[model samples]
Target: MYQRFRSFFLLAGLFLLSACTSAGITVANAPVPFFEGTIERDIVFDEESKQTLDIYIPDRATEERLPVVIFFYGGRWTNGEKGDFAFVGTTLAEQGFVVVIPDYRKYPDVRFPAFVEDGANAVGWVHKNIGDYRGKSETLFLSGHSSGAHIASLLIVDERYLEDGTISAIKGFAGLAGPYSFTPEAEDVKIIFGPPSQYPQMQATTFVDGSEPPILLLYGRDDEIVAPYNLERLRRKIEEKGGQVQAKYYSDVGHIEIIGAMSWIWRYKAPVVDDLALFFRENSDN
Candidate 1:
């Protein structure tokens, strides 16, 4: 009877946890006015399955051709949902830009190309559809936290993934504490970054070149998850290739802190935010 009760409680706990994961965040807590309005819907990028995106538009915009940013949330390529970032939508949307955040299939359900394909298609979707939301930059920017950053880096380094999905070119890339150039260390982490033998191609730095988009890289000095060397390597590579890339390393911020700093609570991250905005503004205006 004790075992039976234990299993029943365990199952109940799991169900409750999943419910919590899917539920909307305290989105209303974010300061108002930053988020003027919102658009919550799904677009089936793949017809066979319901692969889709949940996009949001910034509140105050002057014109129809507003700049657009596509954000990918990190979950180690598993166990993350769209509802997890309702706050991201609210915050960036308020910034006079349109943001599209998408949910891609996670591990065990589908692997690399599947999730990568979804990301590229999500960008294509925005490019093809952002005008409907008044997001009008011919230039598109990509940003992500942790694993999502990994995928972003990989997409730039290995352009095939985007080409396959029809996203053509990405104007800029931003990674916050992303595990770019991650190696076969930390046992499990190695599998996600690919065995060391794949080095240059898998490293986000390898893809930094004149043809590649400008990159604004941010990292925390105290990050325990992804090392600081990852950013250094990419910075050096991009510089070597004559690609425009700027990197900022924070002294006290940690991995998650860097992401938190971007929120409405920490406007200081605004510099980092502005770096991105300026990069887009400069590139798109031309």
Candidate 2:
């Protein structure tokens, strides 16, 4: 029995290290039954083809409205799909929050500000329509992993992507292994937010003025892709601006594992989901 479990975990680790995709993480999560929830897929949040989102609502006898979470998956701003993160939605929904996973235009298809604009558009749609799903828009929390986290954090701090009303509605944000501040050394990445001179504007750290909503930054100490300084720089800026910010670092966890820990199979590796739930609840009025 011990060897069987060890083999399973070893295989799972290999999968996670290779790619942080639904197929990779599902190896462990598929065997466990998901918590009761209603998954509404392919709901269009904008006129654009990729501007669709999925909502996961917990099954409950009471009609009490629940806090809403909009999670964006990371793909280095190049690749990702809303359907690829159903596990994320279902897991958070199980924790008593309505979870929304939105699809945005990716690089090669669109450039900076375009994808960010799509994010704002999605938020606007949620604020106007989430009540019908028993979600309290006023208690909305933004969250994402990797590049997705960059998008979410930028929306909250930049204030230019989202409308004032929509931005004000966000109660908190949680970022996992986000690149809050960094220079794009890769040619493709540079082109994604190009014109060299405007690179600073592309960073979330550029807009921290202390008036933004509370933020929770989660990262893995062993994350080589994003580097731990990204979290520290953002956290330091937010704190220097007198904004509410909290950070949690996991030892022995890497970039992909930080978010992968949210899944049931690898959840024992860290308390990523629990920390997210607590942060959201703490910042919410509902």
Candidate 3:
């Protein structure tokens, strides 16, 4: 058991180290590339300080409007910042897609529905303003990893959060290792999405129907933090409603590594970047 544990961490460390240069980040505390492109920083999306976002314009500018992707980073609704996901913005933007990463208020400071509400506000803001950054309002997509995915999923499944027109503006939704069907058994999870009865409101599964935007569910087969069952459950629910949904599992990846593979060096682990680009393009109106 000891030897097996040692090997697991050793392999994980090697994989993580491989992406340092490509991501321009060696450690979590290392400076993220804030000046890589035309970055619009700290744009206010709501009244709270945490409800701010950063926009990354593609390197290749064109008169033709580009598709936009509004992404949220995952940290269990208690921790995370859009700055931590600069690599995600830069990589997707480099592919000629306008990317916006938003920061929402987390737990301890607030609780359930607040963060998701902030996500809804950010989407509304993007729908109203992405055109100024050369993005097509009609080609807007939503994506996130883990908790961020949960928030993004909720925005699509629950129409109440977004105005009718804004909901129509969403072309697709992509989630990475999102917990869409869990019942929140852990104390911390219960606190974040609990009172038991309220768990239904926090679940994306509760709102899945054929009316949702096209959905892509990506998961790491080896993920222990969020089991693959969550993906399967959500997929089943969507399919039952005759919704357009697809699920992909990466055998070589775990939770963090699935999203981590977006970096240049980690592409070999999983072609998440290419797959996502294809999914977004195929689902976009343009």
Best by lDDT: 2
**Which scores better on TM-score, 2 or 3?**
2
Local distance difference test values of all predictions, in order: 0.68, 0.87, 0.85
TM-score ranking from best candidate downward: 2, 3, 1
Candidate 3 — which residues are off by over 4 angstroms?
A: 1-36, 48-50
| Alpha-carbon lDDT of model 3 | 0.85
Clashing pairs in 3: none
Candidate 2 wrong stretches, greater than 4 Å: 1-22, 28-33
Candidate 1 vs candidate 3: the lDDT winner is: 3
- Best-performing candidate as measured by TM-score: 2
Model 1: colliding residue pairs: 34-94, 58-93, 65-136, 66-136
Q: What's the lDDT for residue 14 in model 3?
A: 57
> For residues 90-131, could you state the per-residue lDDT of candidate 2 as single tens digits?
889989999999999999989997888888889999998999
* 1-286 per-residue lDDT for model 3 (tens digits): 9999967855655555645533333432232454356888999989755479999996564687889999988988988788878878888887778999999989988789989999999999999999998999888999999999999999999988999989988999999999988888778879988789898998888988788888999998878899778899999999999999989989969887787777543557887998899999998763
**Alpha-carbon RMSD of each model:** 8.5, 2.2, 5.5
